[model samples]
Target chain A: EPEVTQTPSHQVTQMGQEVILRCVPISNHLYFYWYRQILGQKVEFLVSFYNNEISEKSEIFDDQFSVERPDGSNFTLKIRSTKLEDSAMYFCASSERDYGYEQYFGPGTRLTVT
Target chain B: AQTVTQSQPEMSVQEAETVTLSCTYDTSESNYYLFWYKQPPSRQMILVIRQEAYKQQNATENRFSVNFQKAAKSFSLKISDSQLGDTAMYFCAFVASNTGNQFYFGTGTSLTVIP
Candidate 1:
């Protein structure tokens, strides 16, 4: 089965530094999303993208966060400046259609800010 | 806004036994999807099963099955013939059909299958 793939399974960056987490969603998927989970916490929604534009976002997806579909398959989340609280497991997910709410999640990228 | 709730924080079952993880959600949308995802030690979120809100009959996949009660807003997962590999944190998620598929997940229930 085709699955979402994320680069840099783990990322370590200095506080205040910019970092970008890259993901390659399944080729035929039309909707993409980003979510994060703090240690032992519930996964929180960050943002959703369709047609190369954001559809909805959460409060946590503030000024520092931005998502881009640089190419047909690549969907990336960029953090302008890393904060200690930004350290968490970031997951990229995709679905074949906006109506098929069943999203397939990637293995996830662990972002650690020092 | 929708909220998913998994009241059980932790649960355990003996190997080869059965276990049930509870989940409930508050949503006004009539058309939606509910899912149970398992996060193993690798922390990879794996889809265990899914249930459509409109379906009256429950959904079953192998040893995994769901008991979905639309009127009660309840969706629970039952794992039969549980094995050690079933140990993981299970999360209940909800997504509206028309929206962009942004999920609202529950706090999660840590399930351990002891041998």
Candidate 2:
């Protein structure tokens, strides 16, 4: 089965530095999403994208966060200035229309802002 | 806003036994989807099963099945013939059909399958 793929399984960056997490959603998927999970915490929704625009976002998705579908398959999340509290496991997910709400998740990128 | 609640923080089931993880959600949307996701040590959350609110019959996938009560706003997962591989943190999630599929997830219940 086709699955979402993310690059740089682990990222370590200094505070205030800019970092981008890349994800290649499964081909043919129209909707894409990004979720974050602090260690031992529940996963929190960050943002959702469709038609090259954001559909909805959570309060945690503040000024520092931005998402882009630079290419047909590549969807990325960019943090303008990292903070220590931003360290968490970021997941990229996609679901085809016919599959209903079933989302295929990427293994996740562990971003550590030190 | 919707909220999913997993009252059980941790549960254990002996190998080859059966276990049930409790989940209850509060949602006003009449049409929605409920799910149970398994997060192993790898940190990737995998879909274990799903239940549509409109369906009266429960949803089942292999050893994983759900007892969904629409009126009570409850959705619980039951794992039969549990194995070591079933050990993971299970999260109960809710998504409204019209809400762009942004899930409201519970804190999660860590399930350990003892051998």
Best by DockQ: 1
In terms of lDDT, model 2 sits at: 0.91
> Interface RMSDs of all predictions?
1.7, 2.4
**Every model's TM-score:** 0.93, 0.94
**TM-score for predicted model 2 compared with the true structure:** 0.94
Residue A18, candidate 2: C-alpha displacement in angstroms: 0.5
Task: Write model 1 residue lDDT over A1-114, tens digit each, in one string.
Answer: 788999889999999999999999999989899999999888999999999899999999999999999978799999999999999999999988776457889999999999
Over B1-115, each residue of candidate 1 has an lDDT whose tens digit, in order, gives 7889999999999999999999999988899989999989875688899888788999999999998989999999999999999999999998886554679899999999999
Residue B7 alpha-carbon offset, candidate 2, angstroms: 1.5
- Lowest-lDDT window of 10 residues in candidate 1 chain B? B94-103
After TM-score superposition, what is the CA distance of residue B94 in candidate 1 from its true location, in Å?
Answer: 0.4
Task: Give the least accurate 10-residue stretch of model 2 chain B, judged by summed lDDT.
Answer: B95-104
Assign candidate 1 its CAPRI class: medium
Measured by TM-score, the strongest candidate is: 2
